[model samples]
Target: MSLSIRNQIAGTVTDVATGGAMGSVKVSVEGGELTAAITKDAVEALGLASGTSVVALIKSTEISLAAA
Candidate 1:
């Protein structure tokens, strides 16, 4: 089986709440190195949770990254 590996920055779920009809996922990457806000539905679909193990995909084409 071929496994799809995404370039992810591992972090913790900082917060979670409702956004109108959708939800929100705030993850702190790299020891609070980076924070990203994702949709709650996507979080639920991905089975994400507070203190849950997650992968933050680093999309090169769409977004850029920097060294801090």
Candidate 2:
């Protein structure tokens, strides 16, 4: 797939929590874990689950970039 965002972090899905209309996805990365809150439909559409491999794409108007 193609993407314009570059701050992609490779990680493995650790947990998935879905409610009425929102869902939370937790991914285990190199240093730690990150959680993303998204729509429930999106969660099902992507078929995310524990042990699933995924990429965390970060982009925002207030995004800060620093050398790591």
Candidate 3:
């Protein structure tokens, strides 16, 4: 599939937490992990689970960077 979002990162699914009508997916990237909140239905549709490989597409107007 084609996407307009250019910030894409490949990662492995580390965890999936579902409650109510929403779900949170944690993906382990190079140095840290990225978490995405999505619908539970979407999670089921994508068959997301621990160890699953996924590409995270980020489309945002503003981003903040800080040194840790």
Candidate 4:
């Protein structure tokens, strides 16, 4: 698939938490883990689960970084 988003990270799904009408998906990226909140329907359509390999497409206008 072709996407305009340039921040695509290949990773493995670490966890999936679904409740209400939203779902939180965690992907283990190169440096750390990336969590995305998406609709439950989208989650089901993607068939996301732990250990599933996927590409995380990140498209944002602003990003905040913190020192840990």
Candidate 5:
């Protein structure tokens, strides 16, 4: 598939938690893990599960910075 998003991270799904109409997906990446919130319907539609290999696509319009 073609996408305009470039910040993609390849990882393996570690867990999927669904509640109500929302869902949380955890994926193991190179040095750490990442979690994404998605719709429960999307969780099933994409067939996401543990050990599933997928790419995490990120497209954010805002950036936050804090003084160190």
Candidate 6:
């Protein structure tokens, strides 16, 4: 099935965790924080850093809005 999502947001890498088998990257975009589980090898391949620029492809159905 095709999803209806407008992936039009760009984000920057704020933090990265690579201690485990898979690397986890945190990005801040549109006044929000998003974390994605990426491959450790890919993290190293992309050379991601604290200030690295990244794109957060927003999958609408995959996103959940909540109040804190």
TM-score, per-candidate, Cα-based: 0.57, 0.83, 0.86, 0.84, 0.85, 0.70
lDDT string for model 4 (17-54, tens) is: 99989999999999999998999998899999999999
Expressed as tens digits, the lDDT of each residue in 1-68 for candidate 5 is 78877678999999999999999999999999999899999999999999999899987543355797
Off by over 4 Å in 4: 60-62, 65-68
Residue pairs with backbone overlap in model 2: none
lDDT of 1 at 17: 70
Candidate 3 stretches with Cα past 4 Å from truth are: 65-68
Residues 1-68 of candidate 2 have per-residue lDDT tens digits of: 78778578999999999999999999999999999898999989999999999999887653777996
List candidate 5 segments past 4 Å from native. Answer: 60-67
Q: Model 2 lDDT vs. the true structure?
A: 0.92
- Note each model's CA RMSD in angstroms: 3.5, 2.9, 1.9, 2.1, 1.7, 3.8
Residues 20-62 of candidate 6: C-alpha lDDT, one tens digit per residue:
5788999998879889888899899999989999976666677
The list of candidate 2 runs beyond 4 A from truth reads 60-68
**Candidate 1 RMSD computed on C-alpha atoms after optimal superposition onto the true structure:** 3.5
Error at 46, model 3, angstroms: 0.4
Query: Which prediction has the highest TM-score against the true structure?
Result: 3
Count of backbone collisions within predicted model 2: 0
The best candidate by lDDT is: 3
lDDT of candidate 5? 0.92
Give the backbone clash total of model 5. 0
Q: Which order, best to worst by TM-score? A: 3, 5, 4, 2, 6, 1
Each candidate's lDDT (Cα)?
0.67, 0.92, 0.93, 0.90, 0.92, 0.84
Q: Write the per-residue lDDT of candidate 1 for residues 8-68, one digit (tens) a residue.
A: 6778776667665576667777656445566657767877667876767666565776898
